[model samples]
Target: MKKYTLLLLTIAATVVILIQSILYIKAGASAGKTSGVPAESLARLSEQVSVRAARRGNPWINLRDGRDLVAELTGADQGLLAGEGLAEPMALASDDFDEDGTPDLVTAHRAAQGGVLSFYRGNVDAVYPNAPEAKARKAAGSYTDAPFLSPGRLLATAEPPDLLGAGDFDADGHRDIVAAARGGSSIYVLSGDGRGGFPRSKQIQLPGRVTALTAGEINRADGLADIIVGISTQDGARALVFEDLRGAIKAAPESHALPATATDFALGDFVDGYETDLAIASGSQLLVLHGRDRRSAKQSRPRITSRRFSSAIESLATGNFTGSHRFEVGVLSEEGEIAALTPVKVKSKN
Candidate 1:
């Protein structure tokens, strides 16, 4: 009887150990896998809720649900101040076109057929930014005294574009507007008159529909501003560089194809003194293409390096977040988390 009891006790102990082992394996599988750049190589500074909902611009200014929000960034602290009673905006772009030192604002709203572009000339005034009055006047459509004076809507499009970008594409000292049609292959350029007017729009055709669009000096030697557009192709999403060729009606742009595919992208000089690098959101990864200086030799395609983020990135924005003069990328995750990511020096040779 004693021998049989001892054998039963040993079997019970073995069963308990087996159960614990299985539970441990199950927990490990449920945790998921962590991949991408190591913590020492890339740092996530902060997660902001406001940034996740922002449509365009950096922390200083951004558009949220047709409302314009302004914030003051002081060191590590940031506060958002939103304007009320403004007309509903679908897209926003800003630049100092008139050389007034203050950046001007441009907004696009949905029209019946397509979209309507509006320009707001920037003016600096001590009393113009009064919080209560600006909001009230904006509702009445007579906020001329406010910081952004509306010159009224400038141009209309045949099909409403999903994205808006501004740059001096012609090198004519005024920023022109680039609009990418939603789920369409054509991109439209409306030349800015430097006085808040766009008389006409020129169409540039692409092979595939545009997914994301941004304006930057992709080719510094060209002297004319260029645009980087993420387009959907037969295989997958691809990035294309469209060089602004001055003066050609319905011209086929001198385009360069980048190797990386992206759902959203932003241009910035990630490494100082190098050509502009691309921060791309493709799949669930963030790719950084360290641009090659094409001026010296044959311009080869930029090499892509990637970091798999915890969550899929929905949108990307670039800004000088660290005061390091180098621009960092702000990624809005699909899970509604916003993280500011900057690359750090790698220590391990591997």
Candidate 2:
């Protein structure tokens, strides 16, 4: 018949080239197993979530349902590279203190002769690496001062003093410890006795030179906890809002004014949700202080609604990446270039 019909058309063109080379090797091994991660572990988990959203900027507002959060600090080589820290990172607010709801990290170390508070006990994943420098110098030598050495004079190596939140300032619900003393105007309060110890009690003092502290409940009042202190003299930046009652502190007309040099301050809500709003970082801008109706007749003051980065804003944090609650301003330049402002949507109404 014509050579068996040309050998059955060359065996059906070699079975359609062997089924397209086995579907091109199974589509390149399913694209290497669907993007197989590992680009240096996704750039070290995007630099540890951009260095924990540029250092503690989400100053807590509920959060403890699934809880896995971890953020610990150490000055990062002390050039004061970002938010100027030789020490000052004591935050614990999401409740659970170790009952296991997960939210624990209370730090304080100004050791020359006086401060060294540390209590970290929350682990579902990690954040434990701190209590072993000879057991934090034997629990800071049973306090009374003996472990704060450094050219001493009452332990003066200074620079580590600015942490301003942890709750229950002595209504005895638990959590307590608030700090801020870069040159002192007083606001220390450390009272935790629910079982993990924190003796030092009160010291409110404020008028100027305090620079950044945050905590809020702002008159929605459940048991009281609202203090926002952020002074800085030469009569320019201000933010004192105090109202704690249990540990005692009154002054609350809800002040707010800034233009240059405020560095960092946070208390969220953003606007018109009518509760918390006071995010100031001034000096490359980002200010949004709205909270009127203390009986409102007039008193709005606090405009500048975000002008992020002309450079010179060492820190200001409140993050969500892009999933929700924005405003993540952190800029460290003098030639370090960290950059991150994110939170855009403006047209007017500063």
Candidate 3:
């Protein structure tokens, strides 16, 4: 008798929820009708709800929100050796090195002579305002990689350093270069002069070989950007936050230990917070560390080789590649291949 009563209550509660939802939607529809919205518009709104229900099952697919986005690998750089592995450092720089209106893709390879930076200019027609910028360009030779400046380059290099994270380091309205030394406690800074050139680089000394870098306002409220870098240590990995105090960017007095030899560091609000959180790939695994808002981070035991979560990730970045408020992960595999993973929707187990 008690079980029967409980079942009846559950059914009644579900019916009430359904009726409330229906009435709420109808109220909205009635408002649209009062505002002289056509029945076709309301039907489209109803279709959108059905579409969203279908989208919840597969987050990998792009939205049907009237955007012409196709979720697929549209292009790849086959000739350039992205990297031998995480051991070998390489970077793909996407920016307008010359401050031109068009975007350019710079390819950096670590060399004995400091390092070498090359450019591949983005197609102006593909990016120009008069032209429509589709997610996938379809014109003949539309998406080919061409040498950007014929011969313009950074000319600055590092100690086999894999430096990335480009931004306006000085609020100078020009893109600047930030990188970490993989074998030392130094961070390289090169100020772009708006042209396809940079001034003599400056070094911000930290602790250990700086392997990873992600730029944001990690420390300052002055509206300028700061940086967070990952360094390898004898114990594990430590993250150093450098804020742009005044006009000059300086390293924070101390660092925090993030264990397991961090590599490919990224920043986002992973676990719900106003400040940013950290994500890294280390030893064939992805690690998420809470931000300063939390007391500490969750630590897990190392998994076996066969059950490894990643294929020895060489690099990674997080962004909302799709048309959603949520972000996505792009990983560089050890075999010099790039992989993009859309966040999957999984039901929580109570």
TM-score of each model, in listed order: 0.63, 0.25, 0.54
Residue-by-residue lDDT tens digits, candidate 2, 28-126: 332222133332221111112322232334465433223222223233232222244444444333333433333545544553333444454333212
**What would the per-residue lDDT of candidate 3 be over residues 68-163, giving only the tens digit for each residue?**
111111122322233454233377657665654556565566764455555443434332323322112223222212222222233445554466
Clash pairs (backbone) in predicted model 3: 114-157, 115-157
Residue clash pairs of candidate 2? 57-317, 111-148, 112-148, 112-155, 113-155
Clash count list over all predictions: 0, 5, 2
lDDT of 1 by residue, 138-208 (tens): 45443333344322234556667568888877667777888876577878888877755666678877788
Name the weakest run of 10 consecutive residues (lDDT summed) in model 3. 67-76
Q: Of models 1 and 2, which has the larger TM-score? A: 1
Model 1 TM-score relative to the real fold: 0.63
Would you give me the overall lDDT of model 3? 0.52
Off by over 4 Å in 2: 1-164, 167-175, 179-185, 194-199, 202-212, 215-229, 235-280, 287-317, 323-350
lDDT of 3 at 313: 73
